[model samples]
Target chain A: MARPSDTKTRIQAVARELFMEQGVQNTSLKQISDRLGITKPALYYHFESREALVRSILQPLLDDLDTFTATLAPGDARRLLEDCFELMWRHREVLVMLLHDPGTMLGLDLVERVWEWRKRLTALLLGPSPSAAARIHATVAIGGMSDCVVEHASLPFEEVRAAAVAAALAALQS
Target chain B: MARPSDTKTRIQAVARELFMEQGVQNTSLKQISDRLGITKPALYYHFESREALVRSILQPLLDDLDTFTATLAPGDARRLLEDCFELMWRHREVLVMLLHDPGTMLGLDLVERVWEWRKRLTALLLGPSPSAAARIHATVAIGGMSDCVVEHASLPFEEVRAAAVAAALAALQS
Candidate 1:
């Protein structure tokens, strides 16, 4: 679905492949260029630095979530949470990488982005005057979704998804 | 409760404090010794390196969990699960540190220890032949407790604990 003129899109896809295969720390810009069959200068033309490139990759994902969150109907809370989690699960690798190495400058920037999104979404879900129990529920429900997939990777995808939904629903009721 | 010949205990307390404060990568053996008001040579008498010291610190925690798991009634599963979670909550700092930076050799070793505990506990909780739904419930119940404290640290301790317990009980019923 991504267009060819979108060099940023191409670079992100290639970089994500490399990150998933060899880890973000181990993968290099030159290697990413080589794999993309582009010169170093061409890659540099699109992204000034590796960190910048990573940010570009992450921005759209967060923006998509933001847009999704913006469109949620206040009445359909359960569905809204489910869709948000589905989107996160769809991008599990990025979430997992950001969480594990949150110490790196780029990683921290990405985590801040995630945290901001989390704060916004948490506020929307629990509202400003949530009960202590609702606050706890909202926290666990949001945190557990990504964490379940990250820690329970050996299990089948369906099972992980089911557990996350169950956990979220249980938290909401509590 | 800490005794003088408790060389192991002293070393663990010092290492944990240093690691949590300055991170595992930044903390040094010399600093640990200096803070503990012991000579580097004296610290070396107990632990060969920082990695070894971290392992020593983790040993007792693992031993305690192992003993706890071994004594679980297996019949009174709900109480046993609650007790396990209470222990995890009581030692929350160690869990938070490990989760924050799981890339350290120390972190990897501790993760392996915890995973082994998870494996045994999961088997006891779900046996070998649990249905998919049952497995999901079991996984969420086990994971929800730690998630409550680790992810929901901003909430008051009692609020998080109560919500976590409520969530776990709901998951059991679901």
Candidate 2:
């Protein structure tokens, strides 16, 4: 006897568990509903499609990213990289789900959103009248931080997060 | 009038041009043939599908990657980074085509190959008894270099290359 308000959260949880287990590409909405003991229609009522479901699942991370980018100010590269890495590390599961089947990511509109977000982050990191090479360094710094956590998920969080931030700062300095 | 052997090369070149000028997703095989003033069947004789055509166009880059990775030796990070940066620079067009329509990159089998290649490279870069943080640093170092050139293509080759190599060395030292 689940309440209506909690049903959406429940669905998001089950969908992520299933996506992580069998991969995003292989898991169907029907499978998710079946596991939750709800009808497929019930699932569709909450999420129109897999894209919508993935988006809803990742909305919090996107919101955090949007919030950080909105409040972004000129700062030392290390401080900025630390905040960005923490934001992503907080959403580690989303990155894990994506690492399982990355192709599924491109299908979601979030890719475009993240790309735009990266551009904004890049611009912020670029600072005043930066050289062309400096811009590349800043972009590389940003892109690499997000990627390392996913690629080395088996690594200790504290260890990898620090490493990613260090690497980003290194790129930014270059 | 291309010779039968060179038709493949010509198709690959025109396909890349159309893919770059338009986009990999938007440009059709017919458009490539239309631009080349050749019949669809004639084009088909060279490439059965857009996937095959993209593979053909990027084969040289992939082959170079394979060659370098195959002959990978235990070397200083700067030397390894320089070789990798140069290889990517030489195949700049392929990266440009991909950056234009990144979503299309997932549709090709090359994505899987590239992922696997990344794993192999990460392993090679991870020196003996590496810490989890060290592993993350190495992988970040490797990924950032490839992405920087593509993301900041307008940057001078010498400058970006130097920055990327320097950034990579900084990461490796971490």
Candidate 3:
């Protein structure tokens, strides 16, 4: 038998795959368990519910973002923006699910967390008291990053990353 | 009693308002008729169904976008981008509904239409054979405009418009 941590990781991986393929609303614990050849009870042992599963999958990303933000100094706008783009690109599927399916995030506090993160990232990019134009620029730059990365799924990752980072910096500076 | 055309216009207006306020799925034809102080039959006469009403609301915007795109000359990337931003701003509430409530668009062909429009706009901005980098840049620039304008609901429209346009141009050029 797989270790408990390995099983949990496997479950999360399967759940993300199912969620991406069929949407979070349509995918169920039963489906996830069935795919893994595990009983529902075993799945439940790791994740009490679907919401818990989503939380488990997202918490790491959020925590990583928090850590990334903490590591940033006041004037690291370009590097910070690039890192943000990279983070979103790495988790493009989850971000796409959140962007395209509002129902996936209905009961979760993920949306608010993301909003707060965006605000913090914007402040980081433009300083604490950015002008209205600067604020808009930051907002647009990030939006562009997510949209480009998610939409161009078949593209080479490095090219997409570089283009997205460059585009975001241009938007921010403009 | 209002003229038939006026009644249809009023029904469309009220439906858009209710859809924006309570989401498209939550808003019913009866509720729309009731708010407009018209009988259900009268409302149905104007719009055969809720789906039809949504199509009516979206069709004009799509048509306007088509017209706007056709007006763009080969090198009018900056102007095309600005007009696209303006079109989205004009329908900001509807855009917000589409962005936040995925259910609002279920069974409707709005999403595909929007995707096609985005591709056409990107092609217009970047030319027929844009490099992968240019494509990503265009994608991000447009994403930024929509995110900034929609998220900053209370910001002055002119400021947002100018910033989004400038940012989009910068992203495209970069």
Find the candidate with the highest TM-score and give its number: 3
Instruction: Give the range where candidate 3 chain B is weakest over 10 consecutive residues by summed lDDT.
Output: B100-109
Q: Mark the 10 consecutive residues where model 2 chain A has the least summed lDDT.
A: A99-108
Mark the regions of model 2 whose C-alpha exceeds 4 Å error after superposition.
Answer: A1-43, A49-51, A92-126, B1-43, B48-51, B92-126
Each candidate structure's TM-score, on Cα atoms with residue i matched to residue i, is: 0.73, 0.74, 0.80
Query: A1-174 in candidate 1: lDDT tens per residue?
Result: 656558767888888877655455546788998988888889878878877887776676677766765665554557656776777777777766555544443444555656667666767777777777776667556665666666666777776777678767776676
TM-score of chain A of each: 0.68, 0.74, 0.81
The CA lDDT of each predicted structure is 0.68, 0.75, 0.79
Please report the candidate that would top DockQ against the real structure. 3
- Candidate ranking (TM-score, best to worst): 3, 2, 1
List each model's interface RMSD. 3.2, 4.8, 2.2
Q: Alpha-carbon error at B90 in model 1, in Å?
A: 2.3
Query: Looking at candidate 1, what is the lDDT of residue A23?
Result: 50
User: Per-residue CA lDDT of candidate 2, range A1-174, in tens?
Assistant: 556568898998899888766566557888988989999889877778768888888778778867876887877767778888887778878766654455555655667667777666667777657777777677667767877866766777778788899988887886
- True lDDT of residue A42, candidate 1: 92
Candidate 3, residues A137-162: lDDT per residue as tens digits?
Answer: 88888888888877888898888888
Q: Give the clashing residue pairs of candidate 2, or none.
A: none
Off by over 4 Å in 3: A5-11, A26-46, B3-50, B69-72, B101-106
